[model samples]
Target: MKNARLATATVLTAVLATGVMADAGAQPTSLMDGVYTAEQAATGKALFEQNCSTCHNADYYKTVLQTWRGQPLMYLFEQVMSAMPADKPGALMDTEYEDVFAYVLQIVGFPAGETRLQYAGGSMEDIAIQPAP
Candidate 1:
């Protein structure tokens, strides 16, 4: 009976350890994945038109894409999210920022997939943004 109890305890411990490991390795939920619906992107486009179109256009990032340096999407998003509009930097809400991001993505011709591009924390040097197909 003691041996059977010991085996059961060992099995339970192994199972618990496995579960912990799996959770640790799990990927964080991306911001782009279903965070904004198609309608939200349209709203964001309109907002940009009313608020930011004077200073910047949809092709603002075309040069960046051609250069291919710095954080492709996330880098641009962070900069805009942190300090943009020139007139009112750091004023837009998070959801507004996300909407603008979606609009920018749309302009860039990156077809909106089911996954919204989440900002992955890391060095931008290694991250490669492939040209839109």
Candidate 2:
């Protein structure tokens, strides 16, 4: 019985280690560093209240970040831009999206970067949203 338990534990440990190793090589986690500005985030907050607050609330961050943990920022961005507002899809301006995302990051306690985050067309796929710090 003792030997069987030890074998099972050793297998579980190896499996866990392998999983971690695979994640290490996967796309790097994105950081908030220099991604957006305090000013942008502030503006984003206003936009959020006016345009987004109706459908989304404080819990929005938890839901979104948790769902898109390992996905690219662009994936999240596209989802927001494509089918948001419920009343109208793709209604907001591109900058508005950025601003809204900045606001989201701000509310989630992500530190603002020096410059405002610009829309990255292709590179967004490369930028993974890291788990909130």
Candidate 3:
């Protein structure tokens, strides 16, 4: 009985450890993980220049990104979606806004990734806005 109990405890510990590691691997800890693609960033750049450049620039974003460090990227996305272009807030499609965000990330020196950034299903919330490394 003693040997059986020890085996059971060891198995349980392994299961728990696997679960914890899986959870940790499932979520991204920072933007430097290459969350957006180069193509997406390019699209974002055009959109930003056409819609957001007159009011905001790379320097402006440097300050804003600093203040937003350690926060989720979603918060900034929502802010831009609701209060951008200095005239038409939420005027662009959701994907367009995401593309614009990718541009911002590129300008701020985040590495582009194979995957494009997405706002749906809490992915953005999972990605934290970290300072350029």
Candidate 4:
């Protein structure tokens, strides 16, 4: 009985150690995965028309994206989210930012997938925006 208890304890310890390691080595998110819905992009388009078309157009935004490639998607998202509308900053909802992101993705011809783009609990340090293929 004592030997059985020792073995059980050893197994439990191994399992716990593996759990810790797995959590520490969690996988990073990728923007290639469809992170935003097409409908969401449409919403973004409407919002853009109402909020952003006066100052910039899709073509100009595309150039900005090109300039910011190889960077974290979150950085660009945050930068635009915080500084957009020229007069208003941080006035939009998280979902609004996400919708605009989807619109940008669609404008750039990235195939819209079923999944909403990676949101990563508001931190996208792990997800890199790859250059368009």
Candidate 5:
């Protein structure tokens, strides 16, 4: 039984070590890092105006942005993408959802870049939002 326990422990250690190495090697996309291009932010703005402005106004960010400033855009993206328009959750397309995130980033004063912000394959904790450049 001692041998069995030792084998199990060794296997567990290998799995844990692999997981750590994978996480360390991975590079997460940041929401504040020019992920979305200016065009995308503009497009996202229009979508937000049409779909979200009714309930949430400019002041909403004054409170929420502070807490979310350094977080990944995807974090904010997922929450809004999953449940927004309060009246019509999950109503927007994935592209539209990403666009909306761009708009929110713009509103929070993050600078617009040349690339569009992707909705998946990134974490929010990796980015830091800064005032527009």
Candidate 6:
């Protein structure tokens, strides 16, 4: 009976440890990390001007970032993708949307990184929207 209790305790410990290790492996990355490329941001700037400038500008994104603070970037991406441009929604290619998002991040004081932002398969969900430090 004592050995049975000991074995159950060992199994529980192993299970808990495995859960912790898995969570650590999948930890979310912060938006403050260099996650988008400068070139991508530049392209995004042009796209924003061409498509989104009439309704929104770089300054507008400050409020947006604040509202989205602590949320996954995927939420913002989806929100914009679904209802942007006022007249036409979901009009741009997915990559174009990503580029526009990258541009917004740049204007809002986030540093551009070597990697381009990705949204497919919920990849953007892993990126947390953090306030500028």
- After TM-score superposition, the amount by which residue 51's alpha carbon in candidate 4 deviates from its true location, in angstroms, is 0.9
Angstrom error at residue 102, model 6: 0.7
Model 2 lDDT vs. the true structure?
0.75
lDDT values for all models = 0.58, 0.75, 0.81, 0.71, 0.68, 0.81
Clashing pairs in 4: 35-116, 35-117, 36-116, 36-117
Q: Tens digit of lDDT per residue, candidate 5, span 65-87? A: 65544444455667877779889
Worst lDDT window (10 residues) for model 1?
123-132
lDDT of 1 at 48: 83
Error of 5 at 80 (Å): 1.0
lDDT of 1: 0.58
Supply every candidate's count of residue pairs whose N, Cα or C atoms clash at under 3 angstroms.
Answer: 3, 1, 0, 4, 4, 0
User: TM-score for every candidate vs. truth?
Assistant: 0.57, 0.72, 0.77, 0.68, 0.66, 0.77
Once model 3 is optimally superposed onto the true structure by TM-score, how far is the C-alpha of residue 66 displaced, in angstroms? 0.8
Supply the global lDDT for candidate 4. 0.71
- Give candidate 4's root-mean-square deviation (CA, Å): 13.6
Write candidate 1's Cα lDDT for 101-123 as tens digits. 66765776655655433444432
With candidate 2 superimposed using the best TM-score fit, by how many Å does residue 87's alpha carbon deviate from the native?
Answer: 1.5
Model 5 deviation from the true structure expressed as Cα RMSD, one decimal place: 9.4
- Which pairs of residues clash in candidate 2, taking residues 3 or more apart in a chain or in different chains? 34-113
lDDT of 6 by residue, 3-83 (tens): 999999878866764464354456767778888999999999889989998998766788777766656678789998999
- Model 2 per-residue lDDT tens digits across residues 1-133: 9999999987886676446436556544365655778899888888888888898786767777866665667768889899887688899998898999888888887888776676754545555676676
